[model samples]
Target chain A: MKLVISIAGDNLQSPFDARFGRAAAFCLVDSDTGAWTAHANPALEAAGGAGVQAAQFVAGLGARAVVSGAYGPKAYASLSAAGIAMHLAPGNAPRTAADVLAQFQAGALNQAQAATQDGRH
Target chain B: MRIVVASGKGGTGKTTVATSLALVGGESVRCLDCDVEAPNAALFLHPVLDRRQEVGIPLPRVDTALCTHCGKCAEVCQYHAIAVLGQTTLVFPELCHGCGSCTRLCPEAAITEHLHVTGVLEGGLTADGLEFARGLLQVGEPMAVPVIRELKRWPPLRRPALEIWDAPPGASCPVVETLRGADFALLVTEPTPFGLHDLKQVVGIARALEIPAGVVVNRDGIGDQGVDAYCADQGLPILLRIPMERRIAEGLARGRSLLETAPDYRPAFQALLAAIQDRVNTEYAP
Candidate 1:
């Protein structure tokens, strides 16, 4: 199963975007088989129609699960509806990526939830 | 006179220096904290807001009830902010750059553009006669330009007012938006290697923007001599050197504005103000 993960604060996942300027993205390897690709959550710069294109870009990448720090309500819903799994990474970077993929493979990952869990945003 | 106090790197004491300058400049000045995200200047100045304005960005609102999924809106969007897949259309608010290309390109007129509030611009007066202003980006919103733009458009400070802009770090949109059209940019920096690295980044940005820039070395005793040397080599004047004093850190830790404690530092800020005024006058002399 393909996966999508949000690396920075679970805002959104962008595998192809080089946004945020200095964030890093890498493919997580499990059993020496690369199982996931993660990238930084650069601030999004699209408005209106461009927004849809961004969502489409992520959806088409065959991401089944997204392990991110956080996700907005709209994005959570759209990705969830598309059957993309969402995992909340407690921390960020290479460690977060490893932990998330491990949790998913163990079938212990919870269903993706909206950002309002923190009563913020 | 508009004075933008900025640093290319975050946590380099930009807010600290800006707040001190405002306090020293007396009440005839306005201080605008353009660092929308993580604005800490208010923690020191702590002004009561007297005015507030909603800052928003235009996003396309697609009428789902309209027939057809032509995907024309997505095709014209240069930033890829919108997309239509099969019978469904998806919108990523954070990715939207607020350009109206989609609504304009829609042949069926199904897409109507609307404004979405991303942040708030606030203005008020501190008890010490200093005017305070800042923009608060709604958590999760990515765009800082609209808020910064609105903050700048706020009524020009009653003239002759020394405007201190506490700008966001880095050379990105937020930083550019804050520095745009400023008369002078005061680059706040530390004496560390990281500070020197980011300072060069900001200096390049300032040169690109064609703005006259200077440096204010915070924590002068620590770090190395690279900052001073760089300024001399680049012909960028060193505007102020804030010696790394324990009392300064202590006062900040206790939430007391630096000027409130070390009143002697007031003269330094005043002198720096005078020097800046003189330099600007000389440079812009007719």
Candidate 2:
């Protein structure tokens, strides 16, 4: 299974970003192989529907699960519809993508039931 | 001639300037209050706004029975107002820009459009015989450009001596809609840092849109001389200056226009109109 974590920098050690759609970069890790790759988020430049665009991009990447601080309604709808699960990053700011991914692997992270916040236009 | 009284910063007396200019510009003048979000020119002008109409956008509604889960509707929506997920398609009316791209491109023809009312356009004649119109956007509505667009188009003007467009506060989409195709932009601003900062932004917008703009410095004595210096540097002529006064604010609280608070300034506003007309003719005669 592949898991994606929203991050600020290119590496797994990059700081975790609270923003799902406007995150600077997304770090994807293959749980079985432990191989990781970072994909820069293109939705940051989207004038509107940034959440929808980001969700579509992540679904296209074939990630089974996504880790982020929060998800907007639109993003949550798209991801859940594509059968991709969402896990909320534990704790507050200053956390790293790798830190959150470790918690995910340890079964310590909480899975989201629905959208965490209001959607922006 | 159309003169849009705009301000990058709010509460800089845009409505004050626009209303007064309309009063002085004679019965041949019309006032279009384009500040849809918080339109208040009616409070001062006391226009008998008997003529009213609903303003709305064409929002798409998807019929799930016919929807093939093709996701084409989601892909075509630029505003992300629609989403096709698995067997379901959702429509976010607030996010919809009413561009009709999704409705037109739905391959199965499952999408239909309906008018979603967002605002109201009110107009009639002011007590002073000036044709007055304003757009009032519904509370919490994100889009104001559509209402502003309708205000300019409805009950069309008859090439009045001047059309005073009272624009909203900011250099955003609605402001652009208000300034579009105007003969002049009468930019109102206070003499403060915030005023100067936003003024610079709107000036760029005006110049980019190729609209000839001038400044009306309301509350002229309150802030530093930055506005004067910047206007001079930009070669944007200072057409009028309304000094900071307590009586003006007092009068405004009672919903009095600048011309009503101090009718002596009537000549000043008249001169302002003449100056704008002369500049428009001399500089942009077609």
Candidate 3:
């Protein structure tokens, strides 16, 4: 099944967008195989408003669960309203994609109840 | 005529140049600060806004009572905005773009849209008679484009007055929204490698949008000379250069404009304004 996963963590806020605001990291994962693709929040992308498209892209990639460091109430509410499963993965290290998936498969990692604070943690 | 001062990189003096030019242009011009997320232009212009209005976005609201959890809304949502876990229906408003696709696609018609305030737009006049508009996005609010869009919903200019815009940094949505109607864009930059890199990124966007643009190098003495070389290679004119000055930094820290503190630089701004006017006149002449 297709999914749109909101993501957060250290790697998401890397110095990539120093000139612009940092984008939340999101992942699109497959339900059957647990494969995933990563994306920067399109909303925080150049010229803004890329969030919708990014979310759609994640959904297109067949993400079932949105794994992120945190989700503010508004973001949480909006994503929840949209039918996406919101999961908070707070303080997760920037590991290889496999490790993240491993955590997901083992049920050791679940969506955080909330998105982390907006700036540098 | 409208000129948008923008930089793909932040802290490159976009606001400094914009406010200085507005001050030098004197009473006939207006300024709009479209950097809704972090609007610092007001610090320099010191505009006294007489009016303020809330900016809003539409989000889909589901009527749980009227509907069976059919999963149709979930199916229609490209962003996974709606999920039916058993009988419970969940909505995540931040991820929702208010596209109204789910409401229309829902077979049960259980979905409706509601307006959610994202920010506020403020308008007023600076001491020198320049009309000013600014967008202040609500803190922690993820949506900033709506507020920036609201700031641009002004009555069309009835006369030939310069509308200089202070655009937000980054080549993102807010910058695009602010630059929508600009006759020309004054791209500000520093001389750093990172600055040159982002300048290229934004330059591509400007080219794609078909907007005629020029460059203004701030802190002219710092960084490498690549930014200048790149501008020359692109055949884009370097309109003006502001030499690195300690006083300018001090003035900015104290909430004052560079032009206000250094009246001697008025002539430089005037010359810059004249060059821009020439560009606009040549391009838009009847």
List the candidate numbers ranked by DockQ, top first.
2, 1, 3
Alpha-carbon shift of residue B188 in model 1 (angstroms): 1.2
Better of 1 and 2 by lDDT: 2
lDDT of 1 at B93: 67
True contacts kept of each: 0.44, 0.44, 0.03
What lDDT would each prediction earn against the true structure?
0.72, 0.88, 0.72
Candidate 3, residues B1-286: lDDT per residue as tens digits?
8899999999999999988888887677778888888898888887887788887878888898877988788677765555555466766665566778888988888888888888888888877777788889999788778888888886433342788889999998888888887889999999889889989888887887788899999988988899999999999899988888899888888988988778898998899989988987887788
Count the clashes in each prediction: 22, 0, 43
Best by lDDT: 2
RMSD, one per candidate, in order: 8.4, 2.7, 8.4
Worst 10 residues of 1 chain B by lDDT: B77-86
Error of 1 at B44 (Å): 1.9
How many residue pairs clash in model 1? 22
